[model samples]
Target: MEQLTTSLDVMFILLGAILVLFMHAGFAFLEVGTVQHKNQVNALVKIMTDLGVSTVAYFFIGYGVAYGVFLGFNLDGQLTQAMTEKSGYELVKFFFLMTFAAAIPAIVSGGIAERARFYPVLLATFLTVAFIYPFFEGMAWNGNLGMQSWLETSYGAPFHDFAGSIVVHAVGGWIALAAIIVLGSRTGRYDSNGNMRHVYPPSSIPFLALGAWILSVGWFGFNVMSAQAIEGIQGLVAMNSLMAMVGGIIAATFVGDKDPGFIHNGPLAGLVAICAGSDVVSPLGALVIGLVAGALFVKAFTWTQKNLKIDDVLGVWPLHGLCGVWGAIAVGIFGSTALGGLGGVSMMSQILGTLAGVAVALIGGFLVYILVDKLMGLRMSDEDQYEGADLSIHKIHANPPKEEF
Candidate 1:
């Protein structure tokens, strides 16, 4: 039975890893559908390349940084040990978490699409996946540097992020914010008088909607598979995710005045918010969280474009960053026994942890991007931007003119 259990655990996590890995496709299609037609190929290419770069970075360096398990080029030895010890559970676990690590670049790709230089962005992905992200990931999940212990000792409870609300989503969003600031707004996105001189609408709504649906479906694995074992799975998590998704759709539909973009992204906002507390919060609490996140995304996305002039093309900061913070904090509020939850959470710990994540993401992202800019530059040339990334960077348009006979 023990051997059977180990094998089952390995199979479970492996499946979870594959499901979460599929989420990358959702990320690619989402970006492809959102960006202008000229930049669609660039979007697809970035997600794929970023995934490749992130995998290498995490396998070689970030896994060590986060969990003190450096691969150090010992592939055969590592696999042998992993197989003997619990049927390679650790290896499959790595695959699952590596997908999460890859998501940082995926999120940033959306915000900085169209105008970022290709190789520079790849460099950023390497540095971030191999270093910055793992630093906080170590703290939140692995108790690295005793941060989680200190939080629990001081606050009566450790921060509770069952999945990766603050660690992945918020960190990605804030890092994207830093990259956006460094890259500046896309050319002609705004006039010298701070007026909107150009508007880039979605190139394909069907593709966008398809991407959202894929993400929404795959998110169950992203959340539920964080359990890492079949016995740990809960129907509650699935139900709560569903409630939050629908709640977000309803709220964004009403608040965004039935905008298709908002409607599709609404469920994503909710899923992002619920990730931190899916296990603890009641379905109703999850719904409320979703509603708030949906409304917040619409409002903040519009406000940033108009007031702050941040050219976050997909509103990643609002959808991921702000909603992720809310998810972390909401765990304390709605996860308490007083609120029909399982309890054992602290608001102060949640706030502190969330703030720590934000600070690290912003500062680390800015420093990395700035250093990369100084070293090799980060933005496409004006001529390149006008020509579009598909043609300028990748040497191919998303849809080339038919060849002459």
Candidate 2:
């Protein structure tokens, strides 16, 4: 029974890792369909390569930094066979965690697309996955530096993020915010006097919608698989995820006034927000959370673009950053037993944890980008910008489509 159980656990986590890994395609296609045709190829290449670079960084440094386990090292500080009694559950777990770590760069890639140079962006990704992201991840997930203890002592219940609402999504979104500010708005995104310019329409609605669909489907795995063990999986997590998704879609549809782009992105915002409390919040609570997140994304996206003059190409900051914060804090409200949730959370802890995440993201993200900018520069020249990223960086258009009949 023990042998069989270990195998089952390994298989369960391996499946989850595969599912989250598939989300990368969703990310790629989403970006590819959103950017102008001229930059479409660059978007695809960026996601694919970011995952590649992130994998290398995480395997070599990020994983060790976050977990503090060096493969074969035992308590006595002596080497042992890599495979042990758990039958290599630790190795499979690394694969799962790496997918989450890689997502940090994938999220930032969309925010800074088109104008930024390729190599510099990759360098930043390497640094973020290898050091900055892992540092906060260690604090939040692994209890590094006794932060979770501090939160538990001061507040209550130790900042309950069952599935990385703040750790991954919020962290990604906040980091993207820093990169966007450092990179600045794409050329002509604003005027000399800081006025809004023409809004660029998406290259293909079909592809954009397709990307959204893929992400929505894969999210089931992302949320459900976070349980990490077959016995740990709960039907409530699945239920909350579904309710929040529909709520986001319905809310975005109405709030965006039936805009297809907003409608498609609506579900994503909801899912991102619900990730924190899906395991605990009621279905009704999940719906409300989704609705608010959907509406909030639209409002925040517009605010960032027009008011703050930040050009987050895919609105990642609003969808991931702000909504992520909302999700984490929502745990206090929605995850409480009084609201028909599982309880074991408090408002103060949520707030402090969210703030700590944002602080780390801003500080780490800015420092990495600043150093990279000074070293190799971040954005392409004006000439490259006008030429578009596909031609400028990749030396090819997305698809010439050969002349029509």
Candidate 3:
């Protein structure tokens, strides 16, 4: 019976690992559909390569940094001991989490698309996945360095991210913000007078919608599987995620005046916001959170581009970073017993933890990008940007429909 339970747990997490891995396709397609046709191939290639490199970095370096598990160079020896100790579960857990960590680069890729140098971005992906992300992840999930203990002692609860609304989404968003700022806007994105002069619309709405659907589907595994054990599963988490998704849809639809881009990203914003507290909050609370997240995404994305003049191609910072911060804090509000939630969470803890994540992500991302810029440069030349990343880096256009005729 014990063996059977252990096997079930392994299977559950392994399934989750596969599902989250599939989310990479969603990320790739989302970027592909958003960037100009000339840069579409670059988007696809970058996501795939980033995932590949991230896998290597996480296996050899990141997992150790996060959980203190050293996978020595000898794979044969590690597997033998793992099988004997019935600790094969750890392998699947790493697979699941490695997907989450890899998402940092995936998120950043969208913001810096079209202008970032490919190999340099790959290096950033490796460093972010290997070191920066795991540092915060270790503190949040694994209690590394006693940060969790200190939070609990000080605020009456450890930082209460049931999943990774703050840990993963917020961290990724902030890091993307840092990268985008350092890399600057894509060439011709703004005017010589510091006015917003460019408007690069989506290349394929169908592909964009398809990517959102894939992410929505895979998110079930992303959130539910975080339970990591069948015994720990709760239907509330699934239901909350659903409510938040629809709430985001409704809110974005109305607020965005039916813009397809906003409509599609609305659900993503909600899902991002609900990830932290889906298990604890009521469906209604999740709905409110989703609605607010949707509005926030629309408002923030527009303001950043038009007012602040930040060129986040896919609005990753707003969809993930700001909404993630709200989700982290909302868990405190909605997770209270007074609010029809499972209790034992502290708002102060949530705030502090969320702030800590932002600080780490921003500082770490800036330093990594700045160091890379000085050493090897980060953005492509102006000539390369005008030529598009697909042709400049990949040596192919996404589609030569004009020439094919």
Every model's TM-score: 0.98, 0.96, 0.97
Order candidates by lDDT, high to low. 1, 3, 2
Candidate 1 versus truth, CA RMSD in Å, comes to 1.3
Give the 10-residue window scoring lowest on summed lDDT in candidate 1: 71-80
- Model number with the top lDDT: 1
* lDDT at 200, model 3: 92
Q: List residue ranges in candidate 3 displaced over 4 A.
A: 72-80, 401-405
**How high a TM-score does candidate 2 get?**
0.96
| Number of residue pairs clashing in candidate 2, backbone atoms closer than 3 angstroms, sequence gap of 3 or more or interchain | 0
User: lDDT of all the models against the reference?
Assistant: 0.93, 0.90, 0.92
Can you give the lDDT of residue 210 in candidate 1? 88
Taking the tens digit of each residue's C-alpha lDDT, what string does model 1 give over 69-154?
77655555764576569988888888999999999999999999989999999999999999999999999999998989999999
Best-fitting candidate, scored by TM-score: 1
- Measured on C-alpha atoms, candidate 1 has an lDDT of 0.93
Model 2 spans > 4 angstroms off: 71-85, 401-405
- 57 in model 3: Cα distance from truth in Å? 0.6
lDDT of model 1 at residue 30? 93
